[model samples]
Target: MKSPINLEVVHKVIDVFRAQYKNRDLAAKTEKILFNLAATGHRVSEQNFRAIVGHIRNHDMMSPWFIVSNVNTGYWITKDEKELSAYLDQELNRMSNQFDNVSNLHKRLRHGKTKGTGNQASLF
Candidate 1:
């Protein structure tokens, strides 16, 4: 049977590096990283690599994820995932509570208005 293709090579390579370099403190160049990834039988295109690098820098690395860049060496690096899901869960709950509080305050402020005022307040 043919081997299944790697869909998200960049993410997979990052995870592998995270595990492989758990103890070592080293930043790898883009070429070195690509080589290492290739050694593991994963082929990544330059466009995909550049896109993933940009993505990691932007959007805070998939929201709660983080990748550290070695400015001097131009190497992409990260130490950990940092329990992103838990962080996002807490933020989500906090935002939900804030919205609820605002909704309650709005209701209280509008309590004195007409019962039929269920829509936006008209200026006309």
Candidate 2:
């Protein structure tokens, strides 16, 4: 079976994300959009993918593609499919950590205690 992720393809998707979102925080949104596009069974070109990845990487976005492909050819470096799966698993784990951190921060800010306590704290 072929790998689901190709560096070339990831590059293209990144390009599309940059063009469409134009913001660093657009990763999750871009992922959803790209997933929808991909689910439609449409194929994207390598050059376009490379351009996209380049744009995102240039802007310092966290790209999960680099974990799979070589820096030069945007091609897969691993011959084993299991290795590729493992790489993706690691990336997802990293993303989950980041998400947890952000979620905790947001939760803290939302529930932050104000100056006045007792009755106000109870109300909150």
Candidate 3:
């Protein structure tokens, strides 16, 4: 599939993180990065930013980069062993919680505990 943002712009965003490597305090937030992109004449939305960043994190293999994002610290490139480990732990926890929620909903639906609301119909 084609990327939502241009390759050049993707590289630019990566470079922004790269420049802040190991500098946890310098992590840029999504809004700040989007603003920077807009200032540079790139028409990027928050969704586009998420899409490109998600792609880079999951698929980009040429660059040995790990983008660490946190609610408090924002986003930054990290090569530190400890920081990367923590990031992985955090992401895993988040994913686990998400899965748990989905599983709960599935169980509820299977047990017919929830009726369809409004115009929505139960798929089961």
| Top candidate by lDDT | 3
Model 1, 57-85: lDDT tens digits are 56454333344444354343443545334
Q: How large is the C-alpha RMSD of every model relative to the true structure?
A: 12.2, 15.0, 5.6
Model 2 earns a TM-score of 0.31
lDDT of 2 by residue, 1-124 (tens): 5334455656555455445443323333333554544764546454444455555455545433332442222333232457567656866888888776676555565565664543323322
lDDT by residue (14-108, candidate 3, tens digit) is 76666544468788788887876777778687888888888788876325667778998688876778988999999999988877667656666
TM-score of 1: 0.43
Instruction: In model 1, state the lDDT of residue 90.
Output: 60
**lDDT agreement with native, every candidate:** 0.57, 0.48, 0.73
Clashes of 3: 0
Looking at candidate 3, what is the lDDT of residue 70?
92
Which residue ranges in model 2 land beyond 4 Å of their true spot? 1-51, 54-75, 112-124
Kindly indicate the candidate among 2 and 3 with the higher lDDT.
3
Model 1: ten consecutive residues of lowest lDDT: 62-71
Candidate 3: regions farther than 4 A off: 1-5, 20-22, 111-124
The local distance difference test score of model 1 is 0.57
Residue 52, candidate 2: alpha-carbon lDDT: 55
